[model samples]
Target: MKIGVVSDTHLSDRREIRLPQELLGGLSGVELILHAGDWISPRVAEELEKLAPVEGIAGNNDGMDIVSRFGYKKIVEAAGVRIGLIHGDGYGKTTERRAFDAFEGQDVQAIVFGHSHIPYLERKAGILLFNPGSPTDKRRQLLYSYGIMEIREGEITAVHHYYASWD
Candidate 1:
């Protein structure tokens, strides 16, 4: 199964800004999309659902409506693999550490998280850690980015897909 992962779309609070066309292009053909949150606008998920089925966790910047809708963490099972999802927003510990703690003792093979808008991929202790970064808000990063993950025969292959611009 091929999955598109994304996070930290800090769009406007009141006025809705359209998501990047390039993001949809990058996500094209994926069976599902996993959003790690900070999707400030509800429209973010709405727009993405047009491409494929969407699921997400809530972030620190997310309003109550969003928080209530998606909660703080999730576990997704697709094509015989389990993926844990979190926004990586808590008062203590590093983002990656927090992510690990969220699903401790769980049966997930991969954990997808975001809070720092920096792409990350690591394998530790039998789990794949992934952060898709922010396609709309790169902050100090040089380029906008997202991630793609493929699961085949009980193996996971994930890579960051960087773009020069989201427009």
Candidate 2:
């Protein structure tokens, strides 16, 4: 299964970029899409759904309605692998580790989150934690980025795709 992962698209009318070509183009052949949050607008969600089936959670900037409708987190079993998704508030407190703790008693192979708008892929305490970064909103001179996860036979491998300046 191919999973398209994205986060922190802080889109608004004032924001110059909405979604980039890298992300829209990369959606090809994806079985499902995961948006870790900070979508900032409902239109973004609507557009994303057109690419593939989407599972999303609301970020801190998301209004109450979005949060109430979307929930703070999501967990699903796909391709025989259990995956956890969250928008990851509590930024400076090691949100990744805290997410693991939140699901401490649950069964999950990996947890995905986004809040700092920085892409990260690493294993902590034998559990995989990832952040796809902000596809539209780059922070601290970071490049725009997204991620893809290939799952087969219940195992998952992920790759981060960042937008080049030329693009």
C-alpha RMSD values across all candidates: 1.2, 2.1
Q: Per-residue alpha-carbon lDDT of model 1 for 1-167, expressed as tens digits? A: 89999999998657767777778788999999999999998888888899899989999999888888899888999889999999998877989999988999999999999999989999889999999999999999998899999999988879999888855
Give the distance in Å from residue 19's predicted Cα in candidate 2 to where it truly belongs.
1.4
Q: Model 2, poorest ten-residue lDDT window?
A: 12-21
Best by lDDT: 1
Weakest 10 consecutive residues, lDDT, candidate 1? 12-21
52-76 per-residue lDDT for model 2 (tens digits): 9888889989877668767888886
Whole-model Cα lDDT per candidate? 0.91, 0.82
Best by TM-score: 1
